[model samples]
Target: MYRYRITAEIRRDLERIELLRERFDNRGTLPRRWLGRLRRDLEAESVAASTMMEGVRVTVEEVRRLLAGDTPPTVDELSASLVLGYRDAMSYVLRRADEPSFAWHAELVKAIHDRVMGGAFGLDAGRFRTIPVFISDGSDGEPVYTPPAEDLVPDLVDGLAEYLESSKELPAPVVAAFAHVRLAGIHPFKDGNGRTARVVAALAMYRGGYRAPEFTSLEEWWGGHRGEYHTAFDCLGKRWKDSSDVTPFVAAHVAAQRIQADALSLRLATQREIWTAIEDRVE
Candidate 1:
């Protein structure tokens, strides 16, 4: 069997259902200003993330060109335009490819970090090490685990993959929650594990028929609640270290998803209102 780790397809499905519930609850009463502002914010975030990952070489006009169905530039061309090295640019393009699901394993996380940070951070892209890695603002710290020494990783990943494949029929929110917590507990990479886990969670949700996983910024949300996020992960990690039961992690995942859903609902309502106003002006 293909071993997998921390796949959360079911949890993401549930999130979509909940989104629908919120939309229905609001009925036709959403305001124009709110809807317009939310749409603009969402679009702005998308552009910012794309630029951050892709680099500064590609201008807004170039991005618009690509989005307008123009022939997409090659990785090398994009890199030259974005002022990034050839490999870094290629890696960014590959990660955002339509085939992102092709690399749904823990190893892929390291690969992505290395690709993104190789020249920028002078990191060795070939090997996984146990060095300490931290994010900006002194948050997101953890001792790294090299694969062979960290024997639990492979098994944990396999279990996660099995869970995902077996529970393919579950809701997206539940699946996303499952994938997020399991990956977070495993803490697979020396760096970028959280970001990678979030990406995987988003991918799981996307594959399960939800829109792109960029709706609510989990990173932005978790960054604001760093202490609580870490505490929840630590709680689950301790349980996994002792009993191997994932209930605690699952609970945390559900709670986080609900928070995200609530935020998304508010944004969606706001966007609906804004769009209505824009439409009225056009008329």
Candidate 2:
């Protein structure tokens, strides 16, 4: 299992998340319809960013179009498939997040990958790799990290599921972070590992009661801060070793959540002002 401690800073960040979550839950005067629109926007942004991280060149606008069942002329077939596939996967995660019977298992993980990569290309959809896979350095295509052999993937994924099941005591953010890093490290599927890992992390947060709209937006942050996102995985080393402390990666995940919460706070304040002004005008 990945080792991490909830440091003082992380604890403080979690407090901030709690505060912001409270604000989201208690919307004061913001209308539910307005929140619905914001949620859709977040969904589009998330789909675009998560797919883009895997080198898909779809924009948020394109994603919105695809979600609306309209295809942009400029979006290639591959990009369209990638965007829509991810949108479906995120939708699946959102639906399952609140289910009381949800369990972390190899099938759930595979199902997420299936939704993400099912028809995007001819690539293997939900099955673990039958051969070796390597993470390449972006520019030169040189191998950077070697995932565990194909034989170990099924057991490793099962172990991950067990860990998630038993990690209920940990904070949601920590569990989310660990899931993200571990899945990425495991590279269980032949492709879509990063996307699957992110979706799994989002599921963790949602199940832990962080299902507010703003919580779904971290993939946008990760999309923009790709360098930091990849660097955070340094704790995993060049292989799937269990010895390294993943505190830094967990800290980074918490920080991302905090940042998103702060952004949402500002947006909420602005919206509240607008709402107040409209009320005064109507009065």
Q: Which is the leading candidate under lDDT? A: 2
Global lDDT of model 1: 0.50
* lDDT tens readout by residue for model 1, 29-121: 446566454544544343334344322345434444443445346434434333222224333533554563553554554555454343344
Name the regions of candidate 1 deviating beyond 4 angstroms. 1-40, 43-121, 124-127, 130-148, 151-155, 212-217, 237-242
- Which candidate number would show the highest TM-score if scored against the true structure? 2
How far does residue 101 in candidate 2 sit from its true spot (Å)? 2.1
After the best TM-score superposition of candidate 1, give how far the Cα of residue 253 lies from its true spot, in angstroms: 2.5
The residue-by-residue lDDT of candidate 2 on 236-267, one tens digit each, is 88877855689999999999989977987797
- Evaluate candidate 1 by giving its C-alpha RMSD to the native, one decimal: 8.6
lDDT of 2: 0.85
Q: After superposing candidate 2, which stretches have Cα over 4 Å from the reference? A: 275-283
